[model samples]
Each structure stands twice: as structure tokens, then as C-alpha cells.
Target: MKVALVGNQNSGKTTLFNCLTGMNAKIGNWPGVTIERKTGTIKGTNYEIVDLPGIYSLSPYSTEEEIAREYIFKEKPDVIINIVDATAIERSLYLTTQLLELDTKVIVALNMADILEKKGIKIDEKNLEEELGTKVCKISALRETGINKLISEIKKGDKLKRKPIYDVEIEYLISTIQGILHSSDSKIRHSRFLSVKLIEEDERFDKYQTQEIKHMTGLLAKKYDTDFEEIIATQRYNFIEKVREKTVIYKPVKDDLSDKLDKIFLNKWIAFPIFVVIMFLVYYLSVGIIGSNTVDMVSNIMDSFSEWVGNTLQSIGTSEVINSLVVDGIIAGVGAVLGFVPQLIILFLCIALLETTGYMSRIALLLDRVFRKIGLSGKSLIPFIVGSGCSVPGIMGTRIIENLDEREMTTMLTPFIPCSAKLPIIALFSGYFFKENSGLVSASLYFFAIAIIIISAYILSKLVFKNTSNTYISELPEYKLPNIKYIAKEVWDKVIAFIKRAGSVILICSIVIWFLLSFSFNFEYGVDIQDSMLASIGKSISWVFYPILGENNWGATVSAIQGLVAKEQVVSSMAVISGFSEEVGEGSQIFGNNTIFSSFTAASAYAFMIFNLFSAPCFGAIGAMKRELGSNKKLLKVVCFQTFLAWCLATVTYQIGSRIENGTLHLADILVIIAILLIIYLIVKNSINKKKDKCINCPYSDSCK
Candidate 1:
């Protein structure tokens, strides 16, 4: 038997999925869609479950909403579990009403019941069950409460009666619409709920019905000289308000630590500053303090094992081919990716804690004004925050954003935010080159990414995509103390996903990259190709990156190779070519006296790091962009623009820095000046043109939704 889980945004459906499936869940894209569909099996049961994306309604407005609606309508699961956030039952009920109109059977899982009780909100489960005419299970998916009851309910496989408890006026409207039915049976038969939907102007559902409903409703309206639908909608909302009054009881808001924190954290003037401080603290702990120390210690242990294994192979008369493959190919490749695991854990830990404590949403609210100025809505903040872990999941998080153009732009630029995968590269360069000021380097890189995104959004808003007409309305959920168990589970899930990806795609790519550098058919002999490939490729592309990376630095050389795969591989690729085992600490130097190290100026290294950090992200990011943009042409544009920007930034940095270092200007310096002037001109032209256009004609320019 197959079952599907659906829910509203932040409705705890994912928590339920995690609890039921444990470690058995598999996440991948839905066929022909970028939306991720999580598949897993219920433990010790024959039943399997599919966790569809959390959506507000079964409307074909967004990819996530479409996926949920399609799965239920087409796949026709044996059962559909609609997880509802119990605290905000009124808003959540909107989706519930729509789901009941569908062909599939549904069980309402009222999640977060524990939180509701704690807030002194009372829900009469029996009353709710009778009113909905479906099985209602009050389950706290996070606390493992009422889960057994839910599972047993699902296992029973009983169908409940279908009924309506609508207001009398709405019910009358429904009956009147039903009286005009063209046939007693039509696959596109309109429900009373759907009839009301047409009145409410629900564009998503109105078209799904046959023309009979529209024609009949029009005739009735003309006969009455009034649109009955609008009158009934007002009555339905009134009835819902009355139900809410009886079903929900609210007490005076209580003061808590979370509230106290929010007072300072969410202050309009200081919130941005506080966020900055918090970010610094995150990096300080993750990369500068505890996490960084742990990684160095673990790397030292791995280094010992590497040396021991190398000696053992030497004693056994192992061939250079075997040694390089084992040591350089397998060890260096996988180890390079694994080296950053500690930092990843700490990063995930911080994010999880913040999110669990409800700090992230506050950040979203505080940053909304700033984001709006850049032509993005505050809803995009979730995707940007999620992107900090990995661009793939980050892009997936844009499902929460309701607007198409805003979501697409967010998805396109989100990869610019440095994810955990790219942390290793940043840490490597900052440590090796910049020393203890690594924090500043890392922070500057982050700021650079933000700048790039803001600039891109501005340009895209004016030139490519126009601002969406949909207005943004977000509520700030009252803050509460974060549950430790919830935070730990969230953090651990992220870490596991990271490890799984590393074990699969990244591991394979690492091996393949090792293979490419391992063998080459030379003029007379098949030689190990590291040196030859570096010499050939580096020399050929040396002139292109010379302004930024200098003539022959290994950093530039490895970057060229890494561009074929991912930006993170630049650091790993350099480590391999430099013949460093896992012996290096965060700040430990590996290769090149003044030659490799001094080949490029300090400014050049900074520029090189910035380019890689902001440039198209990894393959995962590209795939995510492709999915979210829903167009190959758009993805290509993003990729091309990122690369172009990286080149321009790098070129200017090298020219200016090199000139300053030598105390003499060169032709490159002149080009850098010209490029800077051109950028300034472009910005001025864009701004002037926008103002002129707005002044000339704009229907809703005053209200930039």
C-alpha cells in the first residue's frame, strides 16, 4: 500500500516523515520536476510512504503545490495524510477544505499538538473529527507522541463518511449550484466547495470544472441580480470566525526567554547588527574555535594512518602505480572532502539551533526591507538560509515563496551564498594565505556573495524579469524556547544528507578526478599525468588568469582543473598536485617556497578566492538553478553571468594589487581603471533608465509589490 503526506508550509510534515521512516528515507527530484519527493517505508509494515512537498493548497500555482495536487489526482495513493499545524488551525484549515474535494481518501494529522496545549489552546478532537467527517489524529511528530495511534489508524484502512458542516447560506448556495448540474455524474463535476471557489475567484480550481458550473452560476446571478457566490464567501468566513472562537481559547501572551531575546534581536535598528554579530560568532566557533580545532586534530590522526600505510606499501614492494592510486587517488580525493566534515557539523549545529529557537524567521523579517530594495521579497530569505547548508536543498526551500518571479530569482542567486561544501575551500585559502585573519577573509567572501546577489537581483529586476504583482504578507510566529531534541534531529538530518551525498556523487567524482590525473598516454609511454596535465593546461590558460592568479602559481593551475567539476575541488586539486597527504593542519603550509606561494600577489589570491566562491557554485548548484528556473536558457544565462563577473573582479583585483605591490603601474592597471569606469557607467545608466521609465508610465510603480 502506498500513502502520501501533504501539509502547509512549516506544518511539521517533514518531522512526521523523519519519525516514520527513520533512516530509510530517500530524497530525489520528482519525475520531470525540480521538486524533491521523499520516499520511505513505515518500519515493520508492508506500507510505503511518499512525502510530497509542503504546500499551502492543492493549487497548480507553484511547483510544490502542483506536485502535491498531481500526486493525489494521478497516483491516487491508498491514503493521503494531510499534516496540519494545530496551533494555527484556522489558516491550515484552508488547505484541508480543498483536499476533501479531491478523489483520494485523507486522514487529518493534527501535528504540534503538544505546542498547542502548552499555549493553553484547546482543541476538541472529537468535535473536529465529526465536523471534518474524516479520521483525525492528534500527533506530535517531533516528540513521538500519538504516533502509534496515528500508525494504527492508517493501518486500519477504514473509509469515513463524506459530509459538509458549512454555514446555511453557503450550503444553500451549494445546493442551488448542484440543482443546475448538467449531469448527475461527471468526472469534472463541481463540488459546493468548488462552486464557492469560483465565487472567491480561485483561478487554480475554477478552470478544472466544465463550463456548466460557470454558465449555471452566471444564470443564477442574473436571475437574482446579485452574485450569490460573493455573498456566500463572506458568510463562510463569518462561520469560520465563529468556529475559531469556540474551538480556540487564547490566554494573555506570556513573557519568556525567547520573547526577551526577540526584543533585542528583532529591533528594527539593531537587528541587522545583532545578526552580524551572531554570524561572526557562528564562524568563530565553527571555523575559528572548536570546530576548526577538532578538524585539525582529526586530520593529524588521518595523516599518521596515511604515513603508516605508505610505509607498509613500500615494505611490500608496492608499485608507484598502486601507491599513487591508493595514496593520491583514493586517499587524497575522499579525504579532501571529508576534511571539512567537522566544520560542516558545527555550521549545521548553529543553523539548527537558530531555526529551532525561531531566530531565522526573525532574520527573515528584519532583512525583508533590505531584500525588497534589491527586488526580492522577504520570503526568499528561507531559501538563502537553507542554501548555507547546500545549494541543492537551499533551492528546494524556495517552495515556501509563493511568487514565481521572486522564487525563480532567489533560486538563481542563492547558490552564491557559501554552502558548507565550499567552506573547506575558504578555510584552506584563508588559513594558508591570510593566517589568523581567516575570519575576516571568510566574512569578506560572504559579504562579497551578498553583494553579487543584490547586484544581480537589481539588474535582473530592471532588465530581465519584472517585479511580481503578488504582495507579501508574513506573520511572525511567537518565539519560544527551542526543543533540544528537535534541534539535534534537524542538525543530524542535515549532517547525514551531507555524508550521503559525499559517499555517493562526490565520492565518485573524486575517484574520477583522481583517474584523470593518474593516467595519460604520453608520446612514448603512459605516464602519470599530474605534472604533464598541469604544465599543458596551466601554460595554455596561464595568460587568461595571469592578471589575477599570476603566471604559474599552482593555485591558478588547480583552479583551471577544478572548473571542470566544482569550485571546492580547487583546494583539493592543489593538495593532490602538491603531494600533501592528509598531514596538513588548517594553517600548515604544504608546497612552493616563494615560487608557488609568491607566484601570485596577495591581492591575486584574494581575487582568485572571490571568483571561485561567487562563480557558478558547484554542479549541485547548477542542477538546482536549472530546476528552479525551469528553463535551460535561463540557467545558461546565470552561469555565463557568474563566470563573466568572476573574470572581471579577478582581473581588476590583480591589476590594482600588482601595481600597488610593485609601486609602478602597467597596461593591466590601465585596463582595470577602464573596467571600473565601465561598471560605474552601467550602474548609473540602469538607475537613470529605471527612474525615467517609472516617471513615464507604471501602473503600480507607487506600490512596488
Candidate 2:
């Protein structure tokens, strides 16, 4: 049996799904839409449950709504588990009413029932069930209460009675359209539902459009002196209100904990500062002194293991080439990444805690105004936050964003946030360059990334997504203590994913890089690394970074290039090439002591960090970008734009910082200064052009005369 879980945003539908399925869910996007579809099997049962994207209505106003409506209409699942927030039943039942119009079994799961009880809101579930013509099950998804009962209700296969939500006139029009659809031999399975949808001019049913239906809709609009869609919507809302009045009893209560906490956390003057402090704490705990201690412990273990492996192989009389491959290539490379797992786990834990406690959404609420000024919805912030953990899901999170332009822009910019894969690089570089202030240095990179994103957003809004508007509508869930079990599970899952990547992509890349670095072009072993195949290839592309790093350091170039496979590989590659396989304390220490990094000044090291942080993400994230973008052209455009921006910014940082530190100017410095001036001039010229082009006929236009 197949069950569909449907509900509004923050309605606890996902929590219920997790409770039902445990850890056995498969997550993917709906066909042709970015809206996520999560499917899982109920434990020890043949029943399959699908959790649809959260939507406010079945009116097809957004892609999420369309996906939900289309899935119900096409798939006709065995049961519809209509999850509704018990505290907001009136608002939620609007969708429930529409669901009842469908010919399927619907068991209304009144989620967050505990919250309702705490708030002194009494919901007459039996009355609600009778009014909506379905069985209602009260559940607290957070506590995993009433899940068995809800599942039992689903297994019972109780069908809901279809009810009319509109007046006689609208009903007559719907029936007329239904009759027309039948007469035309349209293959639309749900004629009644399609008829109502057609009357509302739903773009999904535009194919079934006919003169008769259009004429009848036009007549209805004329009679109502309003939009036909609005008329139908108003009636549905009215029915919802009536149902609420009959079934809901509310008692006034004093300020709750959530409200009290929001006063300080969401205060305008302190909210942003609090967010900054929280983030700094996350970094401090994950990559600062605490994280570094953990990293050192892990690194020492890896170092000891590598030494053991080398000794064992030598005892067995392993070949020198084989010994180097095993010790330097595989062990050092993969070990370099594994050493940062502690830090990654800590970071993921903090992010998971923020997400579960619902503070992430509050951050979105607080930043909405600022996001709007950059031509993005506050929803864009969610992706950026998620990106801090990893960019693939961050880009996928863009599905919640409705505006196509804003979604695309958000996808493009999300990788600018330092993801978990990039954390090792930050730790390595910061530890090497700043030493005692590694945490502060790593934290500065995050702020620098945000600065880049804001500036890039502004530039892209004007240059690419001109005149695009974004609408921000988000539901802030009540604050609750985060579930420790959930946070641990999430952190474990992320760590496991990182480990898998290290074993697979990073492992493969490591072997290949080792081969190239080990052999000359003629396949002769034991050549000087500078004369080896990898070095030759690296030299060919090394000039790209000369402006930033002050020399064509093929080792640095190779590390940067390898980062495209996985960001951690940047440090790992450097570790292998710099002969730090045995040391393994941190890549920074290895690089700092090696002659390979002798030419790198603190300014150049930071420039390198900036470049790597803002460059195109790893192959996995790039594939995600391609999938989310759904266009080869757009993906290529984004890749090129990201690379160009990283180059310009890194170049500027190196040239200007070098001059400031040493009080010396070079030809490249002059060229970089000119480039910066040109960029400023272009921005100013674009602003002037926009002012000149403002519409004179419009009241809001600045050039109106």
C-alpha cells in the first residue's frame, strides 16, 4: 500500500514521516520540479509512504503546489495522510477541504497536538473528522506519539467522503465543466477536480481548456464582479472558517517560552549580533582551540598508523615505488581528509542543532529585509546556511524558493559559503599562516565569503537578473529544545557521507595524482617531481595563480586543481607532494616547514584561501548545480562566472595586500589596481544607466517627470 503525507510548511509532516520510517527514507526531487519527494517503507510492513513538499494549498500557485496536486491526481495513492498543525487547524483545513474533494482515503493527522494542549487550544477531533468527512488522528510527531495509531488508521483504509466547498453557482459551473470534459472525451481521470481547477484557470489543466469552459468561467467572473479564482478561494476559506468555529475552542494564555526567547533572540538590535556570535562560537568550537585539539588527536593516530603501515611494508620487502604509493599516496591523501572529520562532525552537529531548534528559520526571518535589498528572498538564506554544511543540499534547498531568477542566483552563490569539505583547507591554511589565531583566521574567511556573496548578488542582480522581484513568505516554527538523538543521527549521516567521498572520489584521485607525480612522461619511475608528468601538467596551468601566489608554484596549482574533485584534496594533495605523509599533524605545519611553501607569504596564503573558497565547488556539488539549474548553458555560465570572480578577488587581495605589507608596487599591482577601478566604474555606470532607464509613466520610477 502507498501512502501520501501532505501538509503546509512547518506542519510536522516530515517529523511524522521520519517517525514512521525511522532511518529508511529515500530523498529525491519530483520529476521536472525542484520540490523534494521523500519515500520510505513502514518498518516490517509492505506499506510505502511518500512525504510530499509542504504546501499551503492545492491551487498550483507554486511549483511545490503543482507537484503535490499533480502527484495526487496522477498517482492516486492508497491513502492520503493529511498532516495538519493542530494549533493552526483553521488555516490548515483549507487544504484538507481540497484534499477531501479527491477520491481517496484521507486520515487527518493532527500533528503537534501537544503544542495545542500547551497553548490551551482544544480541538474537537471527532467534530473535525465529521465536518471534513475523514478520520482524524492526533499526533505529536516530535515525541513520536500516536504514530502507531496514525499508521493503524492508514492501514484501515477508511475512505473520505467528497464534499462541495463552493456555493450552488460555483458548483453548477464545476459540473458544467465536468460535463464538457466528459463530452470532449478528455482523458483527465479526476473530472470533478480538474473541472474545479480549470475554472480557476490553473496552468496545469490549460490543455483541457475549451471555449465552453472559458465562456462559463467568464460568466462566473462577470456575475461575481471579481476573479473566478478569487471567488472560489474565498468560498473555500469561508468553509474552513465555519469548520473551525464548530470544532476549535481557544483560551487566552500568557507569554510562552518561545515568545519570551524570541524577544531577545529576534530583537532587531541584537538578532544579527547574536547570529554572528553563535556562528563565531560554532567555528570556535569546531575549528578553534577545541576543534584543533580534536584534530591533533586524530592526526596523531593517522600519523602513527601511516608509520606502522610503512614499517610493515618495508619489513615485507615491498618495492620502493609500492611503498611510496601506499604510504604517501593512499594513506597520506585519505588520512589528511579523515583528520578533519572531528571538526566536520562538530560543525554538522551545530548546524543540525540550529535546524532542529528552528533558529535557522528565525535567522531567515531576521535577514529577509537585507536579502530583499540584494534582490533575493529571505528564503535564499536557508540555502546559504545549509551550504555551510555542504553545497549539494544547499543548492537542492533552493527548491523552496519560488522565484526562478532568485533560485538560480541563490544556487550560483551558495557555494561561496565555506562547506564542510572546504573546512580542512581553512584549518590547514589558518593553522600555517596565523598559527595561534587559526580560529579567528578561519572565521574571517566565512565573513569574507559572505562579503563576496553580497557583492556578487548585487552585481548579478543588476547584470543578469535585472528587475527581478522576490516574495518572502516563511513560517517560523515554535522554538523547542533540539532532540539530541536527531542531532547525533544527522551528524553521523553527514560524517558517513564525507567518509564515503574520501574513500571513493578522493581515493581514486589520490591514486591518479600519485601516479602522475611519481612518473615521468616516458613512464620512467623515480624522476624528479619537477620533471614528472604531474609537474609538467601543473606548470601548464600554474600561471593562472601567479598573480595571486606571486610565482607559478606547480604544487600549489596542482592542489587547487585537485580541489575540484573534493575540497579536502587541496590539503591532501599538498601533503602528498610536500612529503608530509609521515608528519600528518596538519597540512599547514607540513607546508610551513617545506621548501615548496617557502615563497608563500601570509598575504599570499590568505589570497590562496580566498581563491579556493570562492572557486567552483567539487564534482559532486557541480553535478548538483547542473541538476538544479537543469541547463547546460546556465551551468557553464555559472561555472565561468564563479571562476572569474574568484580570480579577480584573489588577484586584488594579493596585489593590494603585498603592496600594503611591503610598501612596494609592481607592474602586476598597477594592472590589478586598474582592474579594480574599472569594476567600480562599471558599477557606477550601471547605476546611472538604470536611473536613466526608469519608466517615466510609472509612479514609482525615479525618472518620472
The candidate scoring highest on lDDT is: 2
Prediction RMSDs, each to the true structure: 5.2, 4.3
Clashes of each: 0, 0
Summarize candidate 2's per-residue lDDT along 426-493 as a digit string, tens digits. 88777667877888888888888888888888878876776657687456777878777767777888
What lDDT does the true structure give each of the candidates?
Answer: 0.69, 0.82
Model 2: residue 553 alpha-carbon error in angstroms: 1.0
Evaluated against the true structure, the overall lDDT of model 2 is: 0.82
Model 2, stretches more than 4 Å misplaced?
24-34, 155-163, 172-188, 207-222, 580-589, 663-705
TM-score for candidate 2: 0.91
TM-score of each: 0.84, 0.91
Candidate 2, pairs of clashing residues: none
lDDT of 1 by residue, 204-251 (tens): 665545576666556556644556645554544565566577666776
lDDT score for residue 49 of model 2:
86
